[model samples]
Target chain A: AQSVSQHNHHVILSEAASLELGCNYSYGGTVNLFWYVQYPGQHLQLLLKYFSGDPLVKGIKGFEAEFIKSKFSFNLRKPSVQWSDTAEYFCAVNRRTGFQKLVFGTGTRLLVSP
Target chain B: GAGVSQSPRYKVAKRGQDVALRCDPISGHVSLFWYQQALGQGPEFLTYFQNEAQLDKSGLPSDRFFAERPEGSVSTLKIQRTQQEDSAVYLCASSLDGGVSQPQHFGDGTRLSIL
Candidate 1:
């Protein structure tokens, strides 16, 4: 069975601080990676996705992620964070075959204090 | 509609009762999916439907959990003999195509509470 693991459970940072959320998955085959964000009382929204091609993928709201095949990791990063970026972030993985079902990791709660 | 819509923004059901949650996907969406989100956790896939056919239902926890997209447009998730553990937000999402590259649009979801 495929599973996603998010190393950080909660992260607290001041405004303008650098952000990095670690995500690793347990799958040997081709996979699709995604990062989704859920604001307070809002629905889940896609932040970025990596299907094929470049390992570095840029997403909305100045967010980006790097897919490292060697490490089996797709880590979410932001050069500088804002207070508005406070939300729960989830990392998901979908296998290339076998139904393409998305397996989600336990979310990471980010609190950006101004 | 601009985005996916779910009905009964909030639902409170007694234990052992039955509840039906509705999801209205965006117009012309070819794929629909249902997910269950517990508090402080990521959304878990429940099922997926392509058009009127249910392509995948392996995520459903048990036989008590049922979902249908009769016309391939509107979908419903029905829980029979609901338990306290069944209390969670039910989310619906739709995509333009069922392909791997297309992103999914999610609804605000129906928060179900079993009291």
Candidate 2:
């Protein structure tokens, strides 16, 4: 079975601190990468996604992710994070063809202190 | 437009009881999905439906789990003889289409607790 690996289980950061969450997948086939964020008591929301375009993809709230096919990684990054940015981030993937059932990593919990 | 809506934000059932959760996807969405998220774990795919057709049931953990989308809009996930391990949040997501390009939108999952 294909699986996603999120190396960072939990991360603590102060306001304005940089953020980077590592994500790697075991699937070698063509895949669609996505980042989803869930704030406290909120449903998961789309952060960014990588398809067939440029590797560096920007998403809402000043978040971005770079898709590296050779490495089978799509890592999420932010130049500066705020207290409001504290949430659980998930890395997901699905095949480019056929059923679009997402395979998700365990998730990285980000805590930003002001 | 309203996002996906799930009924019974929280549910509690006895170990041998049965429970049902509901999901109403965004209007006109062509795809609906069910996922189970255990504590401290990411959501895992349980089933997928395209319109009224159930195209994939491979992810379902067991035959005790059943899902249906009779009219192709609303979906229901039911589990029989719930066990302690069945305690988790049940999430429902929908996409405009069942294609790779469309991102799935999730609802506030139904947190189920089996006693």
Candidate 3:
């Protein structure tokens, strides 16, 4: 079975601090990678996605993720995070060839304290 | 208002009761999917449909859970004889096409609490 692993379960940082959440998947095929963010009371929103082409993909809200195929990693990163950026982030993936269901990793809860 | 919508933002039911959750995908979305998110966890795939055709249901936990998109638009997920373990947030997502490249947009999930 395909699985995703998120190395961090909780992270705390002061405002303006850098952010990096690690994500790795165990699938040996062409995969579509995504990062979704959920505010305290909001639905999951697409942050970034990588299908093909450039491995570096930029997303909304100053978020970007790099897909390192050799490492099987698609880590989310932000140069500087604001208090409002605190939320649960999820990394998901699916096979790139078909209409496949997304396999998500255990979310990482980040708290940005001002 | 063009995003996917889910009805009954919250629901509470007895252990043995039956419950239904509805999902209204974005207009003209050909692929609809259902997912279950436990507390403090990521959303897990439950099932998906490609224009009223059930393509994959392998993610469903058990036979008690059933989902349908009869008109290739609105979808419903029904759970019979619900158990306490069924408590979770049921999320619905839709994409313009069933192809692999399209990004799925999600709806505010229906939080189900079984007592």
Candidate 4:
């Protein structure tokens, strides 16, 4: 079955720390990738998406992700994270077939301590 | 009105009772979807609708689950004889079309607890 995976289940970092959250999908076809964030008591929000072209996609609040086709990965990154950046991050993928429904990974919870 | 909205942000129901969850997609969006999120797990697709047409119900886990999008707009997901395992957050999302690249706008979701 098609599925997305996140390597980290939980992560902790101090303020201004560099961040990298890994994501990989198991599909052998063209796909669309996305990163979503959910803060405490808030709904999921789109942080960024990559459809095609430029593999390095930048999104809201200084977050970015790179789509590496060969590795079937779209890892999210941020040079520096703030305490406000603490949240649960999810990686999702839509195979280029059927109705294009998304398959999401089990999210990664990030805690940024001051 | 500006984004997807779900009704009854939280619900508590006894096992075997029927429950209906509502979803109002963004205006002009042609695609609507339903997903179930268990604790500590990703949201799993339940169903999809294009306008008033039900394009895909493959993701639905059992016959007890039903969803409809009447008038090509508002949608509802009804679960019959809810089970304890049915307790989860039900999310509704909408997009411009069922295209491969359209981004889905999600609602806050309704957290359901089946006792």
Scored by lDDT, the top model is 2
Which stretches in model 3 have alpha-carbon errors above 4 Å?
none
Against the correct fold, how does model 1 do in TM-score? 0.97
Span of ten consecutive residues with least summed lDDT in model 1 chain B: B96-105
Each model's RMSD to truth, in Å? 1.1, 0.7, 0.9, 1.0
Candidate 4: residue pairs that collide: none
Using Cα atoms with residue i matched to residue i, what is each candidate's TM-score against the true structure?
Answer: 0.97, 0.99, 0.98, 0.98
- DockQ scores of the candidates: 0.65, 0.90, 0.84, 0.81
Q: List ranges where model 4 is wrong by over 4 Å.
A: none
| Positional deviation of residue B102's Cα in model 1 after best superposition, in angstroms | 0.9
Point out the higher-scoring one by TM-score: 1 or 3.
3
lDDT of 4 at B32: 96
DockQ order, best first, reads 2, 3, 4, 1
Tens digits of per-residue lDDT, candidate 4, A23-75, equal 99998778889999999988888899998899999999999999999999999
Q: Write the per-residue lDDT of candidate 1 for residues B55-91, one digit (tens) a residue.
A: 9898899899999999989999999999999999999
What are the per-residue Cα lDDT tens digits for candidate 4 across B21-107?
999999999999999999999999999999999999998999999999889999999999999999999999999988877888999
The sequence of per-residue lDDT tens digits that candidate 2 reaches over residues B26-59 is 9999999999999999999999999999999998
Looking at model 3, give its docking quality level.
high
Output the number of the TM-score-best candidate. Answer: 2
- Of the two candidates 1 and 3, the one with more favorable DockQ, higher being better, is 3
Ranking by TM-score: 2, 3, 4, 1
Q: What CA RMSD would candidate 1 show?
A: 1.1
Q: In candidate 2, residue B35 scores what lDDT?
A: 98
DockQ of 2: 0.90
